[model samples]
Target: MAKKKYDYSPNDFVVYPAHGVGKVVSIETQEIAGFELEMFVIAFEKDKMTLRVPTNKAEEVGMRSLASTDVVADCMKTLRGKAKVKKAMWSRRAQEYEQKINSGDLIAIAEVVRDLHRADDQREQSYSERQLYEAALERLTREFAAVGNGNELEAGTEITDTLQSRVSAA
Candidate 1:
């Protein structure tokens, strides 16, 4: 097999499309079916879960380095934009929101956050809506924390504050 082009070192924060931000704990070589495979051992701190992804398959699986500062800034700006909630049925919207969260695209996740965010004066969210919102928020905040030199809770609060401020200013 050809070598993978990406260079992810131990301790590097990487985004796995389905999982969000995880740290590379180590790289290990293992023998499976007589083939030696190199794997990346990634730890998701919040989930307390670890995953081993084949190094050669990283790119194919959508594993990527943390978003650049410019991309992160753009995502933050996306959060400040007006919510673009569709008039579709709740089931369809829920599926779309789940897709955006799993896409690991920072700005797309921010769009989910913006659309689902509830202001203090607004009505309470449906349970499903609350679940999707929190999932998107957690995914976005994990990436934010990875790039913002802060913890997840801190980044989450920062994003929440920004969202609330934007809502009030509008």
Candidate 2:
């Protein structure tokens, strides 16, 4: 945590590796092993969950600030491209896609959304496919809303429309 002490604070939005965005609710101190240990308690409203990251181990566990605007810009560009339905099996590809969505990096998550998105005229997505798509979309929207100074619902709609209209196989 000291390595990048300036990177985070209580109430700051942070990306928990593979968990998308969460709000730092508080930095808590507790007695452990007869010594005081500090921890960061972050809450994810979307998942209705809370995570406690040790202040000493936060950086080691991949907890950090949200992606910069330039990084999100690059991700938006990635979203505005074609879906390259890979030749790999669905199970293999689904796992890969899931991993990307969970990665705290916006660009990687955008790639997952871009790859999974299907236009209106395209073939329909499977049950799991739809599930993954919704997850990626939800995750991306929350982070984008936080950075863009907008509400989550608005961000979610924009992301949905943005990805759908941004690309086409034709």
Candidate 3:
């Protein structure tokens, strides 16, 4: 695998696709499968989880630093834009939504959240839909929290409200 080109180092805050934000605790060389591998051990304090990403595969796995304020601003703006709800079958739309959430692109994740969000007056969502929505919401909120230097609850509320208000207005 080719080396990743990143401006970040150990102890940096980065967003891992599908997993949310984590801090690079250390860069270690470990012997795995009879070969020495250089990897970054990232700790997700919020989820009490850790990830070891091979240095070369970090980019391929969507490991990236927190977006700059301007970038984050644009992502949040995406939430308020028109929801491109497709008129496809539920299964088809569900798969597409899952892919967007897992892609770990904040803007794409925000779109999923915005599209699935139903306001207080809207009909109740199915259990599966709720699960998917919650997953996408949590994923987006964690990254937003890291970027805003806030806690999970705070970040979640902000993103949810922003998205909900937009969808409600539609």
Candidate number with greatest TM-score = 1
Candidates sorted by lDDT, descending order? 1, 3, 2
lDDT of 3 at 36: 93
Encode model 3's per-residue lDDT on 134-154: one tens digit a residue: 999888888777778768788
The parts of candidate 3 lying over 4 Å away from their true place are 1-7
- lDDT accuracy of residue 49 in candidate 3: 94
Count of clashing pairs, candidate 2: 1
**Predicted candidate 2 versus true structure: per-residue lDDT over 27-117, tens digit per residue:** 8888889988778999988789999888888888888787788877887888887776789999999998887776666787888888888
Local error of candidate 2 at residue 89 (angstroms): 0.7
- What is candidate 1's CA lDDT for residue 134? 93
User: How many residue pairs collide in each prediction?
Assistant: 0, 1, 0
What local distance difference test score does each model get?
0.92, 0.82, 0.84
lDDT of 3 at 31: 97
Instruction: Give RMSD (Å) of candidate 1 vs. truth.
Output: 2.2
> What TM-score quantifies how close candidate 1 is to the native fold?
0.93
Best by lDDT: 1
Model 1, span 1-170: residue lDDT tens: 78554479999999999999999999999999999999999999889999999999999898999999999889889999999999999999999999999998888999999999999899999999999999999989888988988687889888999899999998
The C-alpha RMSD in Å for every predicted model, in order, reads: 2.2, 2.8, 3.2
Q: Tell me the spans in candidate 1 whose CA falls farther than 4 Å from its real position.
A: 1-6
